[model samples]
Target: MRHATTSDGVRIAYQIEGQGPPLVLLSGQANDHHWWDGVRNDFHSAHSTLTLDYRGTGESDKPDQPYSTAGFAQDVIAVLDELGIDRADIYGTSMGGRVAQHLAARYPDRVGALVLGCTSPGGTHGIERDNEVRKSLAQPQPAARQALLELMYTPAWLATHQGPYNTLGDPDMPAYAKRRHLAASNQHDAWDILPDIAAPTLVLHGTDDRFNPAANAPLLAQRIPFASMHLIPGARHAYFEEFRAIASPLALDFLATARQR
Candidate 1:
């Protein structure tokens, strides 16, 4: 793992693989760079993929201060700057998608094409998850694992796959950092900044997503100028994993097409 020091003195951990144009991958809330493990190879075939641990997770420094999606965007910028990369295509899922919104808006020239999956805009305008889904997320320990699995995948997927399937994200994260991550995600409000994103954007989500809800995908697409939207049928919150066979190809194609244009 390589490291970058943010202006605030926080150390960010990141890894790079394959070769070609840079493609930065951002994981969801409380998740580390490993969140993209299942699909990294597919992307690597066409791009030099960069995955980073958000400040509150993985090998990055976890300061006691508050976190925000905007702050997370800065962490990404620091990494890109450290590597001498002027611009990169970005693929972010869930909370990472929220961070990408800020990155593209706040630092437009640093980002090229963009892909956002299974994410919400947050705040009053965005769709909120169902109360039961929120309750499942609030559960503790072992129970939280099951709750998350159910929320992440469809019932059909759960019934067929069986065996071990975990979705609780960054098991090694400290309790304090986890709480701060949750708070940062909850406090994210990118609705006003969507139009400011200059990157060619594609918005993707599962038709049956209950975690961030599929409705938000269209909202994102509509708000971000010229952005396109795709909803994978029957997939849930973790569509990038559960339906990677479909999702990854779409993202890769979009990024490639955007690069050509």
Candidate 2:
């Protein structure tokens, strides 16, 4: 992994894989680069992948302060700039999708394409999670993590695969950092600004996602000019992890199409 310093003097950790056109992968709240472990390598076969740990997670700095999606967008650019890459396609999940929205909107030259999964546009129009999910996700406790798994995965999938869920006994990020990440995530708002995003966009979501409802997909596709939406039947927030084969290929096709345009 390599390091890049943000304008605020915070260090960001990033890793690269494969050998082709650049593709940057952004993680959701409280997750590090490990979030992409499921499908990153598959995409890496055709594209060079860049994965990063957002400021408060993974191997990056965790400040005992507030966070914003806007600030995360800057850290993304710092990574690209450090690597000497002019532009790249972006894949953002959950909270990271908010950052991707900002990247395509505010730093148009830096982002050529975007893929948003299990995320919202924020504000009143977007679909927000219910109270149960909110309370469970407020802190990364063991019970909360189990509840999260239930919310993030369908029963059938869980029955077939419990390895990932069983291994998730401890919180990956510290309790303080988890709270800070969640705080920043809850404040994410790109409602009015989503339309300003000019990059080609693809919105992937799960039909049964309790964390971020699937209804948000149509709203994002409707708002973003060059956007398409796909919903995975009976899947949840961690749709990519569950439907890696389909979702990954679909994402690659979306990005490949963007490059030709």
Model 1 local distance difference test score: 0.91
For model 2, the local distance difference test gives 0.85
How close is every model to the real structure, measured as TM-score?
A: 0.96, 0.93
Show the colliding residue pairs in model 2: none
| Cα lDDT of model 1 by residue, 1-261, tens digit | 999999999999999999999999999999898888877899988999999999988999989889999999999999999999999999999998999999999999999999999998899999998889878877897787788888888887788887444345898899999889999999999998999987899999999898889999999999999699999999998899889899999999999899999
Lowest summed-lDDT stretch of 10 residues in model 1?
160-169
Give residue 119's error in model 1 in angstroms.
0.6
Give all candidates' CA lDDT scores.
0.91, 0.85
